[model samples]
Target chain A: MKTFRILGRNIRDSFRGVWRNLSLSLASISCITITLIVVSIAMILSANVNNFTSQIEKDVTIVVFLDQNIEEDDIDSLYYDIDTIQYVESITFKGKDEIAGEMMEASETYDSIMSNWTHEDNPLQDTYLVKVTDIDHIAEVAKEIGYLENVSVVKYGEGMVEELVSIFDMIKNVTIVIVIALILVTAFLIANTIKITIDSRRREIEIMRLVGASNINIKIPFIFEGLVLGVIGSIIPIIITCYGYAALYTRLHGQLFSSIIKLIVPEPFMYNVSLLLLVIGMVVGMVGSLRAVKKYLKI
Target chain B: MDQIRVQGVTHTYKSGVTALYDLDLTVEKGEFVFIIGSTGCGKSTLGKLLYRELKPTKGTILVGGINVGKIPNRKVYKIRRKMGVVFQDYKLLDKLTVYENVAFALEIFGLPKDEIHEKVVKALELVGLKNKLKMYPRELSGGEQQRVAIARAIVNGPKLLICDEPTGNLDPKTSMEVMTVLDEINKLGTTILMVTHDINIVDKMKKRTVLLNAGRVLKDYAEGEYTK
Candidate 1:
């Protein structure tokens, strides 16, 4: 019961402090809001970029075209051979006639040019559509599959896949660095703002100290004030990021990146990001105020 | 028994200036003692030492039979809780009402709401400012504000109240009013160690006086003894 009363008093004093130093409090809130917004936008962008990269990775498949003159009976052994290789997930065999028919159905130019060609005269070779367990190992799997008997070519857009993976890696690294730097900067700014508040109330704090207020009693309200500032600061950004991301996702769905690259659906993405922002805000606020109040709490 | 015992206490500031040297004094329980000295004569330093604000460089100060210098930092507040301190500037939170300012001391102890209210009103009533409960410090005169500070210091019912130049910022008339309040509080059996430069109050009141000069006691006089 006594603890509850102290906590209530701390909370009341915190709000009163906030109200008393309205301008400084607002300045701190704005700083937190702006910093969090930048962080949230970075988070949303990285989530979408991650979604797009993984999709691209999933779509990557090795195409193994067989020799045009290969024996019909040799295909079964070839399928068994490809299946045994490590990293080979699945392989689908397509005959030359099926390949030619797919080409004819895909375009009118191909249909007109291939209407007179029979399966015996088809220029297309038999092929295997091979999926690898991991996109990172796609190039190695393609190279290994090329050594198979009667295989003429193994193509999986190795250069494009490698570039895409490297680009995503760079983006991930840069995002981490940027996010960490922003968090530190935010903590520093909040700490300085709280330091100003402590400075302004030095006399009151001195009186409290002289009158026998414990160190914990003196520190609790300032910490509470910091937490309140952080929470208030995070609210605006959370609202902005959640609704802004949802809006961006809605307006640009399938229109900008198309099927090749896509934004993550907003439901779970925004929810997780919002939660992260709130946690960071609260933790930063607490830590900043805790640090700033230490120098003045010598009494 | 002595409520406070200073045994050869000496204090030296970090600037290499000696504020008090080999000073020994004692005040019995419920005694009202006046510490008189000119500026820079270590009067405030004695008041500070009594509250354990400045640990004596040479000897120990035992307050209520506990060695104040040997008390750990975490328990300093406990020792201070047994003593109230009033300052020259009133030190009232300008934004807080006279009532809130007085209640702040007990509030820090997490006293119950009704108890705080009752004690705050009682303390203010003693200071003759119960009618100015809702007024802010800025709204009150200098003397009234000092009374509120007094109310705050006494609200917790501290056994010893240390006032360091409590009237240094007020006029002579207001200073007398403030002194009268302190006198009334002292009559209620709270030991008071007041540091003052006002010779007029010192000579008029004729309480027990400890005169300090150059960080040492120049004279120790009994009740009704004037320094003139």
Candidate 2:
């Protein structure tokens, strides 16, 4: 009962204080909203990058080119042997004529320049396009395919795969650093604002103490005030995030990644991202208010 | 029984200025005592010492048997709960209404809403400001503001109330009326330790008076008339 009464008083007082600081409070809330929006954008960007990378990893494959002189039976058993590899997601066997046809189509522009190309004389060789369960196991899978009988060469974009891994790693590190810096900035801004407000109310606080107000009673309102500010601030960024992502997708629909890659950050991802922003907003507000109140209330 | 006891208490400020010299005094429960002295003679300091606002530099002082000088910092709130201190400035919160100021004490004590409303109305009535409950302190006259302060001081049902020249900012007539309100509250059994320079009111009251000069207790008398 006593605790409820105290909480009631804090609620009343917090509203009163917020009213008194109508302009400053609104300004602070706006700041919170804008900062939170930027934070949300960063979060969404990082999420999308993660989603895009994972999708690419799942679809990426290994291409094992074969010797032109390799026999049909050898090629047939080579596909069977490649399928035996535990890490292989699937295997696609391309014939010599199919490979030469694909090359001819690819080099169609060269036809106008060279004007002399035939499928029979095409240099492209048959290959096994192998998709692996784990991109991390790509090298081992490729090596096993290379050792197969009559396998002339093993060809996959191994360098591109490694580069993609490094890119994801670098992005992860940068995103973490940016988030830490943003959080620190938010905390500092909250602390300074609370400190100023505390200075203005110092004498009033002293009077409240004399009148028998408990320390918690005096502090709760200020903490709540900060929390409100933080919550309101985080919302602005969240709304902007949804709108911004929608705008990006509208422009990038057919221009950037393939339809499969486009499927990665669909509507559901945005929905979850909004929920993530809500959680971040709540925690930031709670933490900012707690910190500000603890530092200045001296309770 | 003596509700407050002070012995050989001395105090020095952080700036190294001596605010109080060896001082000793006592007041019984249900007593209305006037602490009289000149401007810089430690009368306010004594009141502060009694309330644990400022710790005594030496010797022991006790209020309701709580050694105020040795009270831990956090538990200072505990000591404050048992007592109320008023200032010459009528330290009612400007932001809070007259009723809220009085009810603030009850609120801090965690009294229920209905109980808070009851006590606040009762305290305001005691101070004769029942009609002005909704008015802010800034809208109140000096005498009315002081009455609000007195109302706040007593709303917690404190055993002790310290009035440090609460009437200093008021006119003579207003001061007398304010003192009358305090006297009325005292009649309900709250011990009051009042520090004042008004010899006229002090002499007329004929209460227990402790006269301090140069930070020391110059005289203590029962039913004493005030002179300087």
lDDT of 1 by residue, A82-132 (tens): 999898889999888888789889999999999899877888999999988
Q: Show pairs that collide, candidate 2.
A: A32-A233, A33-A233, A37-A237, B10-B57
TM-score of candidate 1 to 2 decimals: 0.92
Choose the strongest candidate by lDDT.
Answer: 1
lDDT per residue (tens digit) for residues A109-139 in model 2: 7545433545456566888889998777888
Q: How does residue B82 of candidate 1 score in lDDT?
A: 92
List per-prediction Cα lDDT, in the order shown. Answer: 0.88, 0.78
TM-score of each: 0.92, 0.84
Candidate 2, DockQ score (0 to 1): 0.51
Q: Judge candidate 1 at residue A63 and give its lDDT.
A: 92
